[model samples]
Target: MDHAHIITELGHANITRRMLATHYAVDSEDEQLVRHIRRLLNRGDLENWKQRVHALWVTERSGVLNDAILGDVVHDEAMEVRTHAMHLLAERKDWNKTQQNWVLLALHDDHPNVQRAAANALSLHPNENHIRPLIQVRETTPDNDPQWLYGMRLALRNQLRDEDSWHSLMGYDFSEIDAERIADVAMAIPSESAGDFLVWMASKHEVKEDSLLQFFRHAARYASREQLNNLAHLVPRKFPNKSELQLELFQSVRQGLLERGEGMSPSILNWGSQMVRQIMQKNITSGETWSYHTIDGVKNTPNPWFLQVRSSADGDRDSTFICSLPAGGESYTGILRSPIFKCPEQMSFHLAGHDGYPDNPRQKKNGLRLVDSISGQVLQEAYAPRNDTAQPYTWNLLEFTGRNVFLEIIDADEGAAYAWLALGRLKPEVIPFPELSPNEEGKRLVSAAQLAGELRLNQYIPNLKEWIVGPVPDASVSIAAAKALSRLDEANLPARLSDLLQHSGKLGTAITALRKAMIAETHTTQRALLSEMVGMLPLRYQQEVMNLLSNHATSTGWLVTQIKEGRLSPLTLRNQVAYSKMESVVSGDVKILLKEWKDSLPAPNHLLQDLIERRSEGFDFQNANLTNGRALFELACSQCHQIAGEGALIGPQLDGVASRGVARLIEDILAPSRNMDPAFQVYLITMADGEVISGMPRREQGNAFVLADASGQELTVNLSNIRTRNLVSQSLMPDNFDELFDDQQFTDLVGFLLHDSSH
Candidate 1:
């Protein structure tokens, strides 16, 4: 970090090192830093946009943007530069009058993202002057385009803090005032304006009944239960009752009942234990009355329907399919409501992201609450275990079954990390074959199985059977299923498991589990079952059978007991190392055994600790050749990481590698286990037949779990075929850099990674 070195790198031919040096220069106080890079921003060539971007980076840290540089950023030929500039502008609110017009011009920018950023910037400094241009933009914006996304609607809401302020919007066609305008648009419009808007629609506009009916459905969101009831009464009386209109009105009545926690049968709310299985069945849309609450002046409701949901059900979603967050950028500080239905024996839903803090009491940030309709008492409250993908959350409604209760999916927190609340349909029946796509549902399944067993929920016994007998359900699911059946005192479970020995594909997993749990002779039946099943393995699977026993083994003596004195059968196999068969690591009668024999081999070391001690200063980086570095990356790192767009994407792209700095990159390369990237963590999966494969987990494509190894080879494994998934501490990045390159080569590799040559 010498100032001369940082300055030199800023102007270096190696893009990576120059970027890294400029990054340091951003925080540098050397008065000459700005003078050194001013031309990079003002350079008029479109081909040199990346330099302009880097110049913007350095200047942004200086805490000033002159109009000329601002002009270059907003009107720069490259949309990338313009978008990046717009982002910087979005973060600024102190813009002068001329600067504000530039933002309004950005509102008309071609790219939606740039326009959104401009909109957000303007929304931060809402003023009456923003209205005309905003309306102009919305009028020309396509219906398919998220008109709300433009920030026009948002600025309108901010501008209209009261009904009197809504007059400017009066003459726009009623079509412009869509359902979302009624449902959300914030409390800035006032409750009275909602009524007035509806009156305007009725008296001045002759619209289709469907569009007219859409208003009631939307108003049902923020309107009170009493208001919904009032609308329910007025609809049938005032509107002519055509069949479709009558049906729509009937739907309103049901929605009103759900709002008040009245009507709806308790049985309709039931969810069975196959809930995970049911969720796995995928693509579920809840049939129950669901509503999203918009704002009421005091406690703000979200603008878009807060109660919108998407499940596996939405894969083929139309515009009508309700979604959470309206494209992940929109934030609503509100709640999505579940209808008031009589509680069935069990009720469940899928939840993902921050489950708010129940400890906050009134705020209960990001939480799900079940409340008694009449008493207004919180009957049972639960929050999702933190996750990004939907994890199944269930309520044992047995105690409250038949009672009128409703569910609330609430997000009262605005913190970026805390506001997410994604949910799926509320359901009653569990599916027979659930998907095993989620990497985090192990704990939930175990707990649910335990609860069912403790309650002797005989109804769930079938789900336990399916889970335990699956081709390759997670080991947690299998063990929990077995335990639940035993907890229910099902005498046939042992016989069923013993019979599954005939199932070489699925129960080979149970075979592995039975051996690990054999430290004590407590489960006599299972021990006998395992003793018999081990003999059932074919000779081709001898290595796998040995692995199944040795993998989880801790004590050698106890394992010997089960095979010898404990009524368990012993296996006869050839020992490859000693070239004899007396016995091995699972144990020897005496001398050479598998554990000790394996210990005799040389230990593998990648020199991670040694490099960590040496640190970034350990290598002589001055001799680095950027050309050699890129070539070396193409040979070594390109299989998983992309740089200059040439390599595979098994790991995070390294285009902005300079941003992470040299020290961080060295640690990541040599000591990846120190701080793992959750999204790119390597997972070791053991199949039921005991085949183990390791790779970086890719997104779940329905029922398939795709994993890519360091070689960039992809293995698509079905969820049902996986026995266990162990998130490995080590990364998919190859750890043999010390073996692969000498000190100079390693130094050059680091140098290349820290520079950008693309520009």
Candidate 2:
């Protein structure tokens, strides 16, 4: 028999009361039918069958899924039941789009678990639809809770066609294509120039470690090896045997051979041996040094462990290198490992002074001077040059045993810093760092791929127009600014979306410029887009964007109303949520609806009330007093009442107290004997296992016995999860306002809880 049949068999009696009276006995007559009864209970519509539904809801909420008939729950009119049903639905991904939208809507749900349930569902398939919302969620979210951000990033990757990179790197299965089809996919790699990447992969024991080697090695034949090599130059290679490839030797020889047309350079063979000798000699004789300026700014100490280089009165700069020996080792033979370059006089180079101190130190006083390697020009008094918060000093330790150019802090007084001193093999190229330039109008515009995509329309502005007119140029723009402009356009949208087509130019730049112009020109769709774009700006600008949108409150209000009336699309709702302007939109009955819906459905009522109240009162969650309620719960109420399976069952479980409303639960707690569970009426020998032994009082047999425990595992348990059992005078809830719950706290506490268990 299914749940319906079993419930009918149990009769209309309150099963909870009956179960309690029987000391949760396993009825032998129904024992054979228990499995069938369970099956039936598991399949019935829980919400309609109040007692069964409440039990299952509680059971599911408590993570007692085995006893909880989860499959039978359905999305229904009862907010609590539907919310719980939605949570259970998380296990089923085949839920239709309507179901999916319901889940998404639950993202704004009032119930925390309902919202969490929605989040869990979205997390399973974090793709385009979910990612944007998740991004909006990241700011207010705790840094430790990586769920929202991670889910959003995952979803964005899916939506942005980044499946290959993510799946490949994270070991996720993104595609179902077979090996032949895989080859077809391989052929579509955009950067065939990274053929060296494929070869590197082919050569790798890890990548092609198993049978996968066949695919990569075969694919390598089709790669452009030359282009791949050039690309590989940029790719970091730290393999153990990489040096054995004689890559440096091969490179030099290949260059010379190609330059001279087949005649190999003799220098190539000797180069490796000479380099090895130099490295070995350096390692044998050279020592490392550490230098730091003391915090007082009075003294510069090259610790005893480091070799000190004092500045000489002579024109030549004094340099120091120091080495400290470990406990077992007597001497430190590590090389100074200075770059092979023409050494300068009067230059104070950094030395490794101490093991823990700064490898590069900063000058306390101003007027520090160091020479620029690229220009050989004297630069004075630079700010702290290194990100070494841990060790602020001179002489950074290299990760591997390789020589590279480094910046050395010159004068402790003169903050000036100089880098590009080649300590070993690393050479500082003269290549300039790329910078974006302004147009003829002196208006800065970025013309990169990202810019092109973000601003696909509008070519009127000279700067933006020029960007569009040119063959695609790769220039950087402020990603922040581009994002800001996008939000702005979204906020001040024009009446006609087609008007956006008029501003067509190079993609991102033109679109941005056009949107800006439109926002300035009229209250057009482009203006709306720009407004919306503001919300997407960095956190630093969130308040600023909010202020800007607030300036046009009337317009925003009208737009929202129009959208709600179906005169406009719900695109505005999308924009509002994206911009996190839901607070401004929620007011009056609309506010009431948003609040009620959120409270009843997926969003937690506490969170909803918190947000609404915070927005209304102008405070953040941290500053809010919601924690007061939790504090109260921990202190007094917990003594008698159990919630979420934690507290004493000498009282009723308070976990579902949240669902029952604060006042009722409070009243019940205040007067326990008034509405005592009829089944709990019998007295029993207190068992060791928290089970209450109770039965009808019999004159002949003396006091009869019955046992009731939290778990349905009814037995004359000599041992229980709870230690001591007693008859208490007070109600299980502990209604005293002083020690247990303060008046405001009680109000807030009641507001926070409203749970029903699906047994």
Candidate 3:
């Protein structure tokens, strides 16, 4: 109704406040009324009242308030009030002592919002006097804090043009500063001294690697031609193993020097350009090219033990040396010789073994050997058991000087075995050699064990078993090796898992292996063994193990008991029960207990449906915590939908979503499948192998189409492999969010989505 009446009702309703502010802007010229409004704005207790005051100030261009009153408002307890006060101060043609002091005070404010406002205000009046205070504040503040970062940038921007400012900036200990921010400021400053300081920082060995990399990148963009040449020379020594960094640095240097009509040294140029080309091509150096040969008078048969050059069986197109032996072939021999080179301290080659035939107890034996061609002595040997998958093996030839070595594949058994070998000299810096460090040997062994599992070579089972039970102190390696062993041979897995469980130190690993086995094991006998083993575990492990086993009919009663006892979380129980395919085992007391538990929890479906039907008609927006809602949105929705450029671009951005109205937003969240954008529709691509993958189509790149899955993982499927593409009627966004979160959580989430602009 009347302006005074609306002003009186500001505390009662948000709409009243808006109407009052609008009326004050257009019609009110009364000084008493302006003072009254200013007093109301100064009252920081009212939520967002300062924003309404700011709206009135903007609409009512005439300044009814003096400097003192505005200065007092700048110190208001609310951040928005202080921010708006700073904005008003920035509009002043010349700030007085009081306003400058207030601006400086706001700069040191703990809130990033006030600090950003202060920074913007200071930018309007860029004075050298502000630099010292900014630097002091930055030095005392934590490096990770955004305030310190913004303060540093603001300080640098104000003083960057002055050559002497570089000295002041460089004098401070930058170790406490974020390297990325330092680089950003350095890049912004156009002074040559700033460039020199960055180059100096880059050259320092004591600098952190992250800082060094950042400094190097910026220096490349800003440094002089002489500095670039110097940096080019140091690149090979400083970052020899970092091919990516080398490529970046080289490109930067080449571009920078070319613009200045200067060039780097021939050797540096050649090395850098060659490395860039090599990295772009993804090429690996196969040392001293090896040639394959069969033993003389061994009767080279095409059916078994024949040497052939072929593409790597692992899908890598690199040429590999393959030695094949057919089933029922016995006593076959072959040798692969490397050209003589000044042999290093050690040389290694990748070897993978696969049995062409399936698992059979009657299959014959197969073995591979490495020998020195000069001495005709076996350096290393391996033998595979029957029914083994392709297994990867590694061979290291040690202490061979100027002598060629031979790789021998011998399939002496009646079963077929194939060996794939690829020789490449590994840089010790890039690839860890087990012999180099005892501490790292465990990690290397773990990698080797995993590779063996990937190749499905059952031949390494005994070695892996020894590693698991051996004196190797690293439990992680032991666990990994045990997992590899389980993958190779499932028959003895229960016994191995039981042995692993005996070591309390490896309980975590044992539990992991046990869980995997339980999920994969289909045999009733194996499941029984798993049950027995799980029973033997300690009580603490039993809860989690039983949770995994909850899908089994035998374990449902145990799960219900745990749930009733408060030992199991409701969320975990709900997830397990919902997804479980176990035959109905709940009866009598157990069924009653489950029903009681369900009744005690908030029913998601009913709550969601009611909220959707009611819309915002009966919703209590004032009580909802927007902060908690933002957290929930980040946890659940941020992966796909972005709001204000803060999340992934997999889905539509929710910026200005308030314009869509609460009802529409609710409907969108509750029923995402309705009236969905055709572009956001999920596509189910069936591969030639019958595997189905569903995701929102991102783009078509070359022969592969990229798609973003619900989990935010991007998948690149080859067009050739896709047998059919079907557009799904449903949205990629999961529909169970309503079921997943409680009513308060759902309200908070929607509140956050509505206030997207505020965030």
Candidate 4:
């Protein structure tokens, strides 16, 4: 194991494992060996010397190497050798001030990778004196250089005790910094001024959309109620047409207010009203009404109900008529008369009631009713059984066909009762309305059913069931309804799902519906029946069914058993399907089976290298067919990426990906994590309940973060329940396109990505 023998062995075409072990054992403690390795590293004849240096660094004992030698290697011609030397120096715990200065110097390295390694080393053993130099480096670095962003993050984290650092970081012009980094700094800094600066930037500065979104996301997690409310005021005015930004602002502000137990400001309330109006496609001004009148039995001082601003469903508060009747007032009545117009397709409003004086027991008898303006017939009535808490209600006036109507608030109780009414609007059309044509209605119903499932609104179970079993059943609508019903009441879902499978005209849609229902079904007998039914389908259809069911724990176990027992073909678990199965099952015999299947595939980089070489030699880009490329992309790539708004948005959108050049595109396809962005890094979060989730961070809401997983499903995990979160270094994008497609097919895909062609 002499140094000469080690150097010769390292230069071998493929060094044997025993030689590596021997080199690791002797190189660190042997001073003579270290000296010899250093001499070889300085020589020009030692080919693959960088590898030798890497092996030497890995084998060298911490604090054993001389400072002068380590410092010299820190400036080596090879970046990898420099990085390895810096890494070795950083491992020493006994580094004095002079040696620590070397780490600081490495932070300003010309190469981004070297700079990142130095930054990581600095984070391991940070010193207060290093903060100023790091800040200086960040200030001088060019914005376009990727290293600049890394420098900025390092500076922000190591800000130390300097109050001025916050201002200096925040004052960087938009060109010098991005919104995401600014927000990250604000979140890390425990100062009110930092949060205020973000709000001010959002309101006064012309921030780009992506950066502004990051700011809003961080604000939701860290900003105060008043600060978020202030930001909300600027949103409607500043980004009137940006629905995503508006939604984020509104949700953040509303959550902030709700958490603080406060009400929304007037400006936020107005913005919410406008959002509702826009969603309903109604003219904002057309719904305005001021004909509220009280009946003759009220006291002279004030009517029982009057127009006021109060908390409503549309945010923390909305403009609505408030009704408050005092005890022993005999009886009081309030009415809001509508302006005459043609009968609307839908009329809806929010209603909330509470005891004005909770101390009095006599306020429990109050009731509110909606009545026809001319006939005085009660359309809907809500009674307050308990007067201590606010009871909210929604009134969908689909049955009310008249042009004019009245909202009647009555109080006959001996104690005071109060109610807030808002979001009252009459729209000409609403989604999933009964009057829509069959296809449009079906699509709308599918969307509504999905929303209901997300919210876990069990009350919608009956409605969803009706959609599934209705006389004119649309396969899409029935499938969506079945899925929603399965979520709401899993125990009672198999029958309805079975009915759809037997009667539906579209076999694929029906099987999908049945598959979803089976995934959620807990009864073993029902699951067995469902599995048997799926087993009878074609192998392709069965594989698709397995893909949908693989995410469920119990269903995955069943499928694995089926595969093992020869009830299902092993070919079903191949390629992307195998990857999906491996990702879903965390632990068990199923995990072992899926992992074995995964390990049997060809090495990813080997396949990638072969493809790259083939393309480099002679791949015809001029004659590549865009249509075929699109077809291949939709089959292999669309599951994660979006192309012309037609695919799942689990990965980055490829709208202008062609402009990024074919070489860059090929590199990405071959080695996705080679230079992966931090934002796109997937997080592996283990919950306190033992459930493991992996996805990219979508947004922060209150104490939870929403993550969108590989299948485009969003999972919201509470911060408190997270046992551990590890940032995965690799990209979520799976590799091995060479195995998935032939040379011509892969070329066509590259052509599709490099041109502006649509399906």
Candidate 5:
């Protein structure tokens, strides 16, 4: 490697100096090589430097490379070079007595950077010689500084190969620091004394709280009961005395025993047994009941008895024993303990307890609430007040719809010690309605009720069965009945009850409902009601109903029958031709007979229908045909572009596009703008040096300075090192919309695109 080039790339600092020192020692050559190496050392750049200096050390200066770099590396003004040099010398084989001594001297260096380097160097050949010194450093150093402790432990870790190093290191004082360090030391101290070191550390009060807890958590991973019992005396004094904690410890130990029990011998059994017993003994003594009044109230029930948790620091770690019941028989043994913490102020706390159970008796008037136990963000509130009768109480079972459920039973009285608060997952209850009968009158009435919103036609046509039966006899006898049925269909019936009876016949009421659904002017909320009502109709009737409306002409013969049957009250045979014209526009089907049918129509025909037919027949003449192309182009294509600022960049600005010519423009639209601008070309390249780079071409001299991929990130590249560069061809526009527009709309859109906004 070009050492000068590498050094220049990285910044010149003390770190680089030490690295150079180590490299020189490793690349032990003649005086000529040394002078050349010294030149690189003179310049000061080591910013983006990386990789091991092994090439210089192992190949060039292998013979002369001892730990000579240690002296300058430790005291180097640049912290980075000192760190690198120390690490370099650590693996060098000439780590003799003198070199070891030098490494130890560097351990006491004031800067943690220096100490870290020395520690790493010493750990390279970890043995018994370094343990005592490491322990000495650890004992005198402040444990709060992680670097110091980390380095000490690192140096000692590899040296702890046997019992001697392990036992020797365990005798030092590590009490004042933290649990993490204690655990680190214990882990290093032969696996045999892992339990012993933890127990001893636990016995000392000087260990920090989090550290001690962390040590137990670590020990729990490997140590068993007998090993744990060896440390039991240390645990009870440190941990808060709670039944839950005791239970958790017991369960963890039990699990550990089961997992590793086969390897355990009888000698370890006694410690395990004793630890379990002691923990269980503490649990038994921790429970105690005390009394307190609900509040200073008129009905002061002083029967409240709560378990006073004696071992915890917070006074609120108390549980009130509401009630208990037998698990298997009439004799009750199960204890019902609820967490009832005393807030700093006079405020009521919610409790979770059941009213009563067949086997487990419930505690009356229970309430429970889960608040930010730490910061007090009240999550849920639940209570069941005394319910003497089944009157609907103001209970918000589910709050905020689905987020949480609040089971509240309000007494509405001045004071209540609302008890229960058990938090679990919430499940919603869905109630299913009963099915309707098939009587025509009943079905129509039900349909009318169902369709009473916007689709009031639902009231008239209950289902396919009634629809097949045809309109009721004497349907339009009175306008009052006609309008009453209409109002019911549209959900707009008057307040009077007798008014609903006027529109009683099946078909008359059904037609009234359908009229309300199709033509009634009503509220928007009611409009959705019509769509929903339409959905309730039998699926088979939907097609028939639409067919009746669509066949406005006598084409289906149904319209003629409706007129003869007096059902076509809205239009007469002579005027129905107007609807036939709409049919021609909507459906472009023209036959020989249909052509003759159109010739007999009224002279002043609708303008739009005539245009639809004319546009349909222009395919025979030429590839291009137009009548009012400019008007068509304006209507279809002005939204997305501007040749000179009138269109949107939803596509590219096209002012200079006329230069590309119509043929290329046509190809661009047919294809798309996928080709990258030469200035904007992006490349994916991996260098021989193993650096991966990709970016847009910012500057392309001999070496390209890619601004970076627009979608990716920026990175520089020497053109020579790049392995890959290619342009991709494919427009990003969707290509499957050929059939979306009519021939005119398509033609119009294309014309507007070609004709500049300047035109």
Candidate 6:
């Protein structure tokens, strides 16, 4: 609106038109219109208190507020007019002492908003008079009232210049009054000067220990990046001999910076390196020194109580233990994380309670995880056995000595019975690896392959050379073993490997291992790779595979008879027409054997129901071939399961099957998932590279998950490199029992489980 029309509206007899004119004049952004409205208010034409307040607003909005008019409105009997006047006064630096006293007196005003406005105004020109009323308002206002304190802070900002100023401003001599109260008031202020006062107070050894955490919290929220960096470097320099004070100050600053998203500062991290080595002995003073998290409704989360400091000999050499079992019966699952620190040469800890269950999948859920804080990968991990004692564990951190890392103590089991892992203090100390004889070199694939090449044990040459030709679970493992053999005796490796491949028994043994590894594999690509490895061995006339077929001894007895009588040259029996295929070839003694194998277990449900109903009935072991039963166990179960130390140890062991009775054994064969244990449940893992694997679950490294299929073949995959991880309800054991054995073979398998007492 034009100035003439706006002035007409302001002079209108109607109060509504006058108010509307005031609103338009304020927002019109026209300085001339605002001055004209100001003139109307000065002349008392706008008589309503609201109109006077709004006219004042229009003056300020258009950068034409008359200080004399605003000064007059400060006590206009209308709180809104006075409040707006006080706010405008607060922003002025040129207000005189009388004007300052006007604001200071408003600080004692009954209404909080007006008092705050006055307090804010007085902050710009605070004097001895402003301090008293500012403190009075602060004292009366709620402690949680942020605005009061913030306003009060401005009035107290000059007081935070140094230690003496703060003590004097607090009106108490440091020694005569409560040191605690001094700290209380000092820590509440947020600014670099306040930080300076805090540091200076620490220098005088006057900072109360009780208020230190709050001080740290205050600094974390408001301290500048430069101030925090100074707290790390300059504080230590000033207090060179006060290491304890230095550490506390450094850690406090370091933690504050982290919480503020000031990513880790190297100097700050270095200042705490020596202290991170003392978690067991030192107490955490910050709100959350460790990152505590939970799954499945875990309770009694990490606090001072969760981080328990024990007597040196309490748990057979303890200092501190991160206790997950807060109330002693919670089957809670949680991960306790330590602050990030550089890894020392070595770190050792102990587990004083159940870290895992024996031979159970829950065993995989509880353990300590040493994580790479930089890359977020798990370098290594360790697990305590299923015993309630202090089980010492030491991780070799030489590989990551200089890298920043944090440790996680995980207890993820929901079983109430002994369901916690009390992780002892992690101290940087060495624990050397125990010596293992070279005689152990070829006994296990993993240990052998890793140690043999490095140690160069010549005795492993025989086993390594045999594995080189083919039939190994992974072609890479075979290659590694071959390389290991070369390291042992490069001169004789090729000949030994060639000779081992040409032998039927050894070649068959290697091929058998490869096939079993294939059985444990769920991925077709991996299975196909194993199959191609099988072709590394040339088939014989009576292929070595003939002896390895699933329990054919009973049906093929006559073939041996025919061969012995010269009626059949079994070695040259090409008329039977053996042919090579990627899939396992199990030729029976007659055509019916192949037909029976083709229809193996078409409907597994019918067989499982029948076996469950009959229990152990109709089993005539008197006619059952005990010798053939052992052969059947080797053929079918050995690949994925173990019995009497003869078969692959990849899957669940079958040592206690005989005690389960005949009916249960029959049901187990037909219904693999009927009553499967969680330890044997399948986990499907998709890797970051898009490869997928299914296997039984095992302990997880912070950055990796270990998976072992029913065949007991295990693989540790990087957790950070995983795209997806899912728990499959089905057991890892395949559901094709009937396909692997016929009536006699099945009967013999049942006999092995039912009557073989030693198994």
Best by TM-score: 4
- Using all chains and alpha carbons, the TM-scores for the candidates as numbered come to 0.30, 0.22, 0.37, 0.37, 0.33, 0.32
Candidate 5 lDDT by residue in tens digits, 511-578: 34443443434534434333443343332232223222332232233333333344432222222222
For model 6, what is the error of residue 157's alpha carbon versus the real structure, in angstroms, after optimal superposition? 4.5
lDDT per residue (tens digit) for residues 387-406 in model 4: 32233455566667654654
Model 4 residue 647 lDDT?
71
Task: Show the lowest summed lDDT stretch of 10 residues, model 3.
Answer: 429-438
Q: How close is candidate 5 to the true structure, as a TM-score?
A: 0.33
- Judged by whole-model lDDT over C-alpha atoms, candidate 2 comes out at 0.35
Worst 10 residues of 1 by lDDT: 572-581
lDDT of 3 by residue, 1-759 (tens): 354554555434465666566556446565555566656555543455545455436333556666655755766667766777777777777777877889889878867777777777876776656666665555555667776467557654765557665555545565534333445576677556666667765665355655566566556556765766677667777777765556555555544443333445665455554553343232111332233333332323222333333343345444333344323433333443333333345543434444334444423234555567667786667554231223334545465544555444444332224422222223232222222222233344455555455446665555565555443423445566766665576443343343243244335555554544433434455554465455445543453343334433445654555455555545443332222322234467666666666667677557757768775565567767898887687667878988988768898878888788778888788778765888788886667754456689997744557899765757666777788887867677766555656778878888888877555
Clashing residue pairs, backbone N/CA/C < 3 A, model 3:
359-387, 364-414, 365-413, 389-456, 390-455, 391-457
Off by over 4 Å in 1: 1-19, 38-47, 110-113, 123-128, 143-214, 221-238, 243-759
lDDT on C-alpha atoms for all candidate structures: 0.55, 0.35, 0.55, 0.57, 0.39, 0.55
Alpha carbon lDDT at 519, candidate 4: 44
Evaluate residue 486 in candidate 6 and report its C-alpha lDDT on the 0 to 100 scale: 42
Candidate 4 versus truth, CA RMSD in Å, comes to 23.7
Candidate 6 on 191-301: residue-level lDDT in tens?
555665454455455455555556655664555555555556655555565544544555556445534445545655555543323321222223224434443323322
- Tens digits of per-residue lDDT for model 1, 1-759: 564455455556678976786677776676576755655456653245566666676777776547787776788777767877877776775777887888889878888877777777777776667766766666655666675454667765675555455576666454534533533454334455554455344444454676655565444433444455455455544554232354444444344334433442322112222233332332222323343343222223223333343433324221121223544433445555555677778877666655444343334466678888789889877764455556667788788888887766666554444456665655763221122212123344555566566446776666665555442213445556666776575333242232233233344565554433322224566555555555555433332333233322222233344444523323322212111212322334333443453345444233456665575767555778877887688667877888877678888887877777677887787766567677887777767755456678876753567788655767567677788888756677655455567777778888888776333
Instruction: Candidate 5: list runs displaced more than 4 Å.
Output: 1-31, 35-62, 66-81, 139-149, 170-182, 188-190, 203-246, 263-759
Better of 4 and 5 by TM-score: 4
Model 3 lDDT vs. the true structure? Answer: 0.55
Tell me which of candidates 1 and 2 scores higher on lDDT.
1
